[model samples]
Target: MSSIYLVLDMQNDLVHAGGPNGKSPLGEQVVARDVVNKTARAIAKARDAGVPVAFVRVGFSPDYRECPKGSAVFSGAPAAGIFKLGAWGTEIHPALGKREEDALITKHRVSPFYATDLEVLLRTLGVKRIYCSGVASQAVVQATVRDAHDRDFDVVVLEDCCAGPSAEEHRNSMQSIARFCRTESSEAMRFETLI
Candidate 1:
């Protein structure tokens, strides 16, 4: 397929009701935006359309060696005990229904393409376009769009499937991202047409 649907960081720690972020403000925004449900539906539609789906997560080792020490983004992960690999926190949210044949991408950083198998997987799949959806619109969503744009891939951000810390942040991030790639709501995305 020339187009692959990339679902970034819909992990338990980030989106599930009982995970670490579940009780925080991010969780409130997620619920308010209904991003988790929309993203799950989009994932199903993509698979039914015969489009490959890649689920991307950001996690680190038990000791947090892979986590950046100085960056404001991830430095607190160690202290907070979140985003650990191979744990319930890092697992794809159950409602999303991850299939065995689907690509499972574990990323140590925010950008899925940064030093990860995502690029190689995209190349192997002959993917020329990417459909993206995920949590924290200001982070993974924006990062993937910009990186994929520079790499010459036609990228589409499924806006309703992405949530940020606040409504304002999500709106601003989506506005900025619109400059580089396309943005569509999950309901408006027609994977069958892309495939």
Candidate 2:
């Protein structure tokens, strides 16, 4: 099958209402309350359809050594906290738990394709049609979709499965990305329809 569904950065650090921490400074400030539920449904649909599912997580090395010291995102991250490998925050959210065969890709940057084994894995699988879904749409979704386009993949972004810091940001990002990739609701992009 050429089609693969990539679920990006759906880790507990970013998703889940009562996740690792009672409240995420970032999530609380943005994202819809139903994001986790929405993405989970999409994942379930993909799995049920036998579509290849790839999970992407944003994490740092044990020492945060791999992280750029000056990056705004990591600049003030707690000296010792989640998002570190093996930590609860870095784990894939409970909603989209990983199975033995699911591909788990740990990304250092926003783009899952950047400096990661994603491309090689995709190539090996002969994936050509990519259904993208994830958080922080303006960043990960935008960059990854663009890169996927450049790499000559048929790309579609499932809007219902993606969440941003706010509805405005999510809407804006989806609107912008619609120019390059097919942006549709998760329901409309159901695996039954696509497969």
Candidate 3:
């Protein structure tokens, strides 16, 4: 079976410097410099192994208000300011080394598969197993794992490649995801494991 690394929304809006979603102190606490470096290393290993890498980002159109203003998420981010397409805050985190050919699956909500073409892209690539890694483990990682499992794909989550609001949150999210998917650290889940 073919394997692909679905690098989740490690966007600047969530993990990079001066990002809108990154403005929170809690976000910073979880997304330390070491975590970012480790994630980059993992991605590099995947690239070297010829495993296809896809990027998922959460962003909206040029208009800052493309997202509905009445959802629960709106209560915390009512303005949807960071979702803008071309804004620096919405760009992928610099450490990921996004390439011109990398596929991007954009969603308006927390789930990368929600209203996105991610599933289709994976199917086209004949991907039977998906390895996920990204920020906000409690939200994005959890959602993606659940969705991937429900879709009948073999899911592997790189625990060290993900973070949450706090270290405890990260740990808890990994524990929860482990119930439905395989959990491994980036160090343990190198390209060799998948290839």
Candidate 4:
């Protein structure tokens, strides 16, 4: 199957220890998991196997015009000043080793496919399967896996490369995600076999 590695929401705000929201409870989980190193290994493996790499970052405009006002999940983003475009918090974590050739899809919401160029890019690359890894398993990872399944694309979640607000939350989300996609550790993912 033609495939792409989708690195979802590994932004500094969500993963970096020194980022704007770095000290938040949610961010601590990411740091503890060493998500950046794990995700970087996954990306390197994908590149070695010739699978395209796509990055999905969640960021709203500086004015927060795209942030939903009524949604509890996003209402505080504007005030907290996290995920604002052009800000360091919105940039991908440096340890992921992003290259210029990787495709970038920026979103203002939880799901990368929602109101984003993800689908178009996937279609353009003729991707039949998506190998996903990122921070916050209960949120972006869960959302993307479900959406990809509904969209008829094969989904694979790199369990070790994903994190959540807590270890329990990550485990629970992985269990739920297994119903929609294959879940495996980064070490077990053999991209050559996938192709």
Model 3 agreement with the true structure over 1-195: per-residue lDDT tens digits: 278888887877777756665658546764573667877888898888888788888776675455766667533443546667888866777878888888888888888888888888888877888888887788889999999999998898888788887888888988888878998888877563343
- RMSD of candidates 1 onward, in order: 1.1, 2.3, 2.2, 1.4
Over 4 Å off, model 3: 74-80, 192-195
Question: What TM value does model 1 have?
Answer: 0.97
Tens digits of per-residue lDDT for model 1 on 11-85? 999999999899788899999988888988998888888888989999999999999999899999999899998
* Ten contiguous residues minimizing lDDT sum, candidate 1: 186-195
- Clashes per candidate, residues 3 or more apart or on different chains: 0, 2, 0, 0
Candidate 4 residue 3 Cα shift, in angstroms, is 0.3
If both were scored by TM-score, which would come out higher, candidate 1 or candidate 2?
A: 1
Candidate 2: segments with Cα more than 4 A from true spot: 20-33, 78-80, 192-195
Among the numbered candidates, top TM-score falls to 1
Candidate 2 RMSD to the real structure? 2.3
Best by lDDT: 1
Query: lDDT of each structure?
Result: 0.90, 0.79, 0.78, 0.88
Can you give the TM-score per candidate against the true fold? 0.97, 0.90, 0.90, 0.95
lDDT tens string, model 4, 38-153? 89988999999989888999889999999999988889998888889999988888898889989889998899999888998888878899999887899999999999999999
